[model samples]
Target: MKYYIGLDIGGTTIKCGLVDETGKIIEKDSVKTSIKGEEILQNIETIVSQFKSEKPITAIGVSAPGIVQKDGFMTTGGAIKDFFGINLKEEIEKRTDIKTTVENDANAAAFAEQWKGNAIGFHNYYCMVVGTGIGGGLIINDQIYRGGHGMAGELGMMSVMNVDNDQHLELNSLSFTGATVFGLLNYYNHHSDKPEVTDARVIYELADKKDKLALESLDFFYTALAKGIINLMVALDPEIVLIGGGISANSQFMEGLQAKIADLKSRNSDVRDLTFAEVKPAKLRNDAGIIGAVYRAIQAN
Candidate 1:
């Protein structure tokens, strides 16, 4: 009946949860991530102190972005400039005197899917999270594959399109730029004079209504997403690619991505011959980072 404190650190928010060994969330809370390194540590200390005050905690696990080492050393913080070159494990352990483990956020999500959600009993798969930007986790042979420097699975930086135009194409140049929710909204607003679209659902709804701009924007998104999925499939040859994020809730997004893949297969005989990995939405949504972080802590302990 031991409990673990799990922290899911992101650019905007830090989600903290007290989770049991069985992957059940006993209690959860969150706080804004401060840009300053010390403030971020203070926020984590506050949350961990509150959780510890109420329950007996064995260890702490954290899911973070950028290059996170097995020893919890963050060499490069993707969005949080303050975390660069910090050993977060020692920082938390010194304050709380509890063993801690840290993992990359996307890798943690992939582990969550294998542990208690979709991709259960699967040996190999890739997990991709699409949001402001794309994040990916590669699981090969049932284990998270951190590259030589523990910086693997960065799918967003992959170059997908190089559309040549007289105007600057920097906005839609990369895979992440073309396939993300922010990209969709930006593209939509860039084209139309209407009030800027805030939510991805608005774009989806407009597409469903046969709005030409919406449809065109979504078409670009699906094409880029399909190419990214194919790139993973061809490179990793995983059994399936589990997609997770806010937009994964929408059924049409998956359908659209699949349609693009199908179209690719129809035209490219090699793609047809080499069976692409099946794409499925992640069963666990936001709680994935918590569960997976707890899982990593337990395993490390």
Candidate 2:
């Protein structure tokens, strides 16, 4: 059986995994992300060497943050400032002498869903990863739609609020300062005089306990997110809208979001006319990037 190495590079950690052709993870590990570009590459090389000692790796796949071109060039590396303007595929191939493929993290997640996760058999769908901010991936006609310059699925940049002034419109974007976990915590902490909480889970628990401030903040979050999903539904009309991220694992959050969407649809006649896409939690979760990257590698080879 041919084996592959998948690496998911994030701001905090670089998650690595070994897998065969069938999408099953054989082993997985992670290393703390480094600020320096060379250090990150070295870490990747070390991981590849360790994995290679155990099995002959056929290729390497990478799932990375920021705007990645089809040729594996990172136009903007998100939190990884050092990755900007670099060709990661060539770099990895040079270091490890293995064929390598690179993909955007959110798009990789969508690929994971298409391959073996919640989006299987769906010809068209959207995947949104809601965390500190939001990231999106679009699958059209069973293919990842990387638009001109590879900036197709940037859903977080969509403005949900109107501003009198043009400047700082990104601040009013759906996910930037509104419909995310960070936004929820920010809203709660700013409004509540009670000792500030950092975690979104804590706020959720407070809401469960009927804390007025927490409930209000969650209402804002749910409303903003519902509006964003509504916009996506009206525009793309996908078969399903899959949500991913740490918060998606919380059943309460998912149920609340679904309920909020339903409430909105019932209130709006225009939205009611549009076919509603089923909102579901992504099945792959943490392993999505790794599995999707490997899937891309498999396709490349």
Candidate 3:
């Protein structure tokens, strides 16, 4: 029964899981993410030690946020600024005296889907995780395609709008500012005269009740996200587009997003001839990174 330690490092927390070779998580836990790199490393060590004490771990796998190179180097660490230029795989190996493999968080999620989730039979697909911001992963021909320099599938960086206000050119990409939960809240609060709500779920609930402000904000969110998906559909023409994140659990959100995409495609003549990829919610959900990391570890062995 070979076991692996899976770590999902995010801006707010580090989710830890002990997974068997079969991809089932035997146990799971999490710890607060630290702004300091050293503290983060120590946290990983602690989690590894705890998990190793209970099982004979074969290797460690990490789902890390940011632009991760193939050899486990962090070119940019997203919210964890301290991780820039650090080789997390080497760091974990040094701390635990065990083999380690690291992958981009979004890519890990996509891998999870390909392994045992909604994308089991699909070889070509795209995955987008929409939350505080948008993260993307691409699977082409049954392999994760991490383009030259490992920056491929960075969907959030794709510019959706060109702002030319005040005689200055500005580009708005699909990110926290426009297409995610953060964007929805910001847009809603900015327009609503009542008290601002921080939770995106609240806005969804309001929209369910036919609240005007919430509906408007959600429309904006879906429109922005649909546009991004439309762009991907035309360019990649994947078999499917799997969306992952906490918000993806909401059936309404998924339906609304697909509806918006259909609306946009109906109005566009150029893309009408292209076959659109089916958009579906990811199955692994919160456990995606953990399961995906473990799957990567299994492959490494």
Candidate 4:
């Protein structure tokens, strides 16, 4: 059976897999991304060659943490400085000898979920990712809505305040995730005479203890997230918003987020009838990016 390959590149590592139409990972593996040279492309080639050994794949898909141009080259990836303006498609294909398609990682994940996962029935909604940063994707009538320059639904970059006469308000790209992670870790550090601690997961693990500081940390996260959602509701009016990423896996935060949204809606009449996106776990989980990448590559090819 013919299969497709998907590659998800991150700051420190790369995850790639072979996926069929059934959304199964026929083969999966990871490798360190040696960004110092052209070895990044070599790493991807290695993964592709291994997967192709047993199965005849038709095309390749790349879920990059950058803006994917229509031609499948990368325009910009905020966290990774080297990938900016790089033609990832050509570089990979030159080594692998296969046609490749590229897309923003968050966009690819959202696309995967929309087509095969939780939001299967929704045509108009938003996909919010809450891991390293809050990234967003908009789906309108079953299509990924990339504004003119393939730069739509970048909710993380949305503005939230004005610092000066010339400066308007803006939310930090990864502030929500960082704040949520640090707020809890900082509290735990004060309670214990231990070494430094950092990680969003650490925060969640400690939430059940109901530590005053941990609760407060959660409060801070939900407040900002609520405001962000409100801002989105006011502007996009999407029918539903699916939450993805590692952080969204926690039910405690999800419950708190719901309460905050309810409170915010009660205060505004125009938004009184509005509802938060039907928040739920991304069915594809880590596989969303790979599956979405495969979808993009297939369509492009």
**Tens-digit per-residue lDDT, 23-115, candidate 2:** 999999999999999999999999999999999999999999899998999998978899999999999999999999999999999999999
Considering every candidate listed, which one attains the maximal TM-score? 3
lDDT of 1 by residue, 99-181 (tens): 99998888899999999889898899988888777788899998899989887888877767665577565444444455455
Clash count per candidate: 0, 0, 0, 6
How many backbone clashes can be found in candidate 1? 0
lDDT of each: 0.84, 0.89, 0.89, 0.74
**Poorest stretch of ten by lDDT in candidate 2:** 174-183
**Model 3: per-residue Cα lDDT over 134-173, one tens digit each:** 8999999999999988989988887775445663222367
Cα displacement (Å) at residue 289, model 4:
0.5
Q: What is the TM-score of each candidate against the true structure?
A: 0.93, 0.95, 0.95, 0.87
lDDT for model 2: 0.89
Better of 1 and 2 by TM-score: 2
Model 1 CA deviation exceeding 4 Å by range: 163-175
Off by over 4 Å in 4: 35-37, 161-194
lDDT of 4 by residue, 1-301 (tens): 5589999886557889998866677878888866653677777777888988978888998888867776876788656767787888888888889988888888888889876888788888888777656677788888889999888888777644223556334433334322344323443565666566677566666677766656666766676677777888788777787887766677876788888878878998987875556655677777788888998877786
Clashing pairs in 2: none
